[model samples]
Each structure stands twice: as structure tokens, then as C-alpha cells.
Target: MIPRFNDHAANERTYLAWVRTAIAVMAFGFLVERFDLFITYASQNASRAAHKLHMHLRLTEWVGLLLIVFGALIILLASARFLRNRRDIAHERMEDYAGPVGEKLLAAILVLLGLFLVVYVGQELAALSSQPDM
Candidate 1:
């Protein structure tokens, strides 16, 4: 039997959880990016003047792309961490990983993203409220 099989299995399970999270993030990003298609379709029937008036930057696409990139980074970082932990376990020198640096960074990033999204939504609402009725 492999030495410390349970420890290795636990490490692998953690790695898989990270992988699942990464995939979820990427999928959400893709959904956000696809909103552009909906916007385009909605604008198709608009008059030229209306089209010109409604034209705006695709912020969602950029945010979605950033999310996808962040997810990919998470996957890479998680793999590296998993390997390091496995090595440590093999050598019987495992250290406590209570909130590792990478996880802390990810949490910080998520907090920032949440704040940015809140501010962005506020700005959009304010803009809509200030616009003159058509």
C-alpha cells in the first residue's frame, strides 16, 4: 500500500474542489460574455438613430474575460499548491495551511470584484435614472 494514502487522497480532493471552483468561475464568465449576443439581437430592430443612441461599450465582455483569466490562474495556483502539499506530506514535514497565501489573495481579489460590481451597478442605475424619457 502507498504510504499516507489517506493524506494523498485528501490532497487530491482539495485539488479537485479547486478545479470545480475554477470551472464554475469560467462558466459564469462565459455566460456574462454571451450577454453581448443578447444585446446585439435586441438592437437589430432599432432604428439607426436609436442604435446610435443606445451604442455603448461592452463592459460585461471585458469583466467576463478578466474572470476567465482569473479562473485559469486559480487552476494553475491550485495545482502548484497541491503538488507542494503532496511533497510535504511524503516527506512528513507538512505544515498547517490555514488560509495559504494564494487563497488569501484569491479572497482579496473576490472582495475587490464584489465591490467593483456593486459600484458599477450603482453607476448604471444612476445613469438610467438621469436619462430623459424617450
Candidate 2:
């Protein structure tokens, strides 16, 4: 009757951490999307070129959407992993830890998202610098 409380507790803690991270990512994504919408609405009275520029700054919207979706996927992954870990610990088969394919995929996606954001910010700065002083 060996107690596996420590193993189960650690697994629960990891699962909770993952959920918290997912929530933060989703909230940030929503904020980004909402901020873009606010900008678009607020610039409706601006000149034609300004409106065009705002319209062209559409990448944030897409990035926000991708982040929200990715957060959801992370939640699902975390849930599945948690259940699998619990089962393995109960059965004393800890040797069969889940594979790293999903984690690798997540890391790759995160890298791509970060790169996209960097490029997007650079473009925005360039465009802003080109504009005449108000």
C-alpha cells in the first residue's frame, strides 16, 4: 500500500500551471484584438492615407486569433497529459512518460509567433517613421 501522493500532487500542480498560462495567453490575445478594433474605429475620421495605413495594420488581428486558438489547444493538451500521468502513476508505469512530439510542436509554433510579432513591429515602426510630423 505504498502512497503515491507526491507524484499525484506534482502532476496536479503542473496541470494547474498550464491552465494558468493558457488563461493569460488567451486574455492577452483578446486585449490585442480589442485594441486593434479600437484603433480602427478611432481613426475613422482621419485622412485617406491614414485610414489606409490603419487598414493595412491587420496582422495583429490575425496574431490575436492564432493566440486564442493556441491557448485553447494548450488547455486540451494539458488536460490529456494530466489524465495520462495520473493513470500511469496509479498503475506504477511511470517509465512510459508521454512523448515530446506535442511539446516540440508547441515550441515551434511559439517561435514562429514570436518571429511574426518582431517583423510586424518593425514594419509598424518603419511606417510610423515615414509619416510627416503632425
Candidate 3:
């Protein structure tokens, strides 16, 4: 078998980097959602404008939550794969690698994620268009 060349340190570093990115995304999402909640509260205290403001705030919260969950899951799965690859490399069992199955699955997941983003954007745009002028 070919000698293992996978650097555990480098792989670990990459995994940590991804984790940090995931944390950042989650934090940002939480902040955005919280901001929306604050807006909702403020609108409730306000006059007639509260209804529209609440709608906008709800949309923001939903979008933010979706993005945060998606990002976190992606990072988690990527990190898991990276660690698995590193382990396989260390064992010098490169031949037993996910040769085709893993690749196909990864591709499918990426495509699904792309489609989801496209649909989400389209829906957001549609909602915006349907709303009255602010």
C-alpha cells in the first residue's frame, strides 16, 4: 500500500477552523434573530406601523435561523469527513476509500443545498414584492 501522507496536525487544524467558522455563523444568526425579536417588541409598543414591522421581523428571524442551522450542519459534516479521511490515510487503507459512494453523496448534498438557497432567495423576493411599500 502507498505510504500514508495525511498530516494529522493539518487535518486537525482544518477541522478546528471549520468549527470556528460554524460558531461564528451560529452567533451571527442568533444576533440577527435577537435583533428581529427586539424589532418585534418595539413594533408592538409602536402605533399602526407595528403590523408591518412584525412581519418583517418574523421573516428575518426565520431566514437567520435557517442559515444558522444549515451552516452548522455543513461544518459538522465536513469536519467529520475530514477526520475520517485523516484516519483512513493514517491506516494506509487508501484503496478502501469511499471511492464512489462518498463522492456521489457529497455531490448530491451540495446540489440539494444549492437548490435550497435558490428557492429560498426566490421565495424571499416574492414575499418582498407582495408586501406594501414601507
Candidate 4:
């Protein structure tokens, strides 16, 4: 067995966790992009076009695509980090390892995205409420 096998295992586990998270992000992006299609189908089935009080920005579709790209980037970075960390562990140079900078950045990005989503939904609701009932 290699020295510090447990440390290597831990690194592998972290890598797997990041991979799972990336998959989830990509899946969410796919769902967001598909929602427009879902809405269109629903409207068509209803036999009447849905009222649009405000112009549809179509931002969700772009945001979803960006999310998928970000997720892909995350996976790539995670694998690289995993290999680097594994090498460090093998060399017993763990002290040279930087902290979780990428993870922190990812968290901050997610938080900003969440805030944007909240604002967008609030504006949508406000617009809907101001419109006259059909």
C-alpha cells in the first residue's frame, strides 16, 4: 500500500463529491433550458396563447447554458486538483497544498446566481400582479 493511502482516499472522495455536484448543476441547467419548451407545449395545448404582460427576456435559457458550461469547467478543474493533491500526498508535501480556493469561488458564484434568481422571480411576480385579470 502507498504511504498515506487514507489521505489519497479522502482526496478521491472529495473528487467524487465535486463530480456529483457538477452533474447536478448540469442537470439543473438542462431543466431550465427545457422549461421554455414545456411552457410552449402547455400553451399550445390550452388552445390560447399565454398573456405576456412583459417581454420575455429569455435569460433562463442562456443562464442554463452558462451553468452547464460552468459545471463542465468544475469537473475539469476538480480532476486536475485531485491529481495534484494525489501527487502532493504521495510526496508528503501536503503543506504546499493551497486551501479550497476553487470551492469557495464556486460557492460565491452559486450565491450570486441564487440572488439573481430571487430578484428575477420577484420582478416577475410584481409584473403579474399589476396586470389586469383576463
Q: What C-alpha RMSD separates each model from the true structure?
A: 3.7, 3.0, 6.1, 3.6
Write model 2 residue lDDT over 5-37, tens digit each, in one string. 999999999999989988988887787666566
Query: Residues 14-118, candidate 4, lDDT per residue (tens digit)?
Result: 999999999999998887666566445434434333444113336767878888998999999999999988888888873654777887999999898778767
Q: Could you tell me how far off, in angstroms, the CA of residue 4 lies in candidate 4 after the best superposition? A: 1.9
Clashes of each: 0, 0, 0, 0
Of 1 and 4, which scores higher on TM-score?
4
For candidate 3, the lDDT comes to 0.65
C-alpha TM-scores of all predictions: 0.73, 0.80, 0.57, 0.79
* Model 2 poorest 10 in a row by lDDT: 39-48
For residues 11-130, write the lDDT of model 3, one tens digit per residue.
777778767767766776677567666555544444435566667677668866965895688587867878787876687564554566644764675576457646754754565556
Candidate 3 stretches with Cα past 4 Å from truth are 1-6, 37-48, 93-134
lDDT per residue for candidate 1 within 1-134, as digits (tens), equals 99999999999999999999999888877876665675455445443344443443367678778889999988998999899999999999958765767778888987887787678657645655565655
Ten-residue stretch with the least lDDT total in model 3: 39-48
Best by TM-score: 2
**TM-score of predicted structure 3:** 0.57
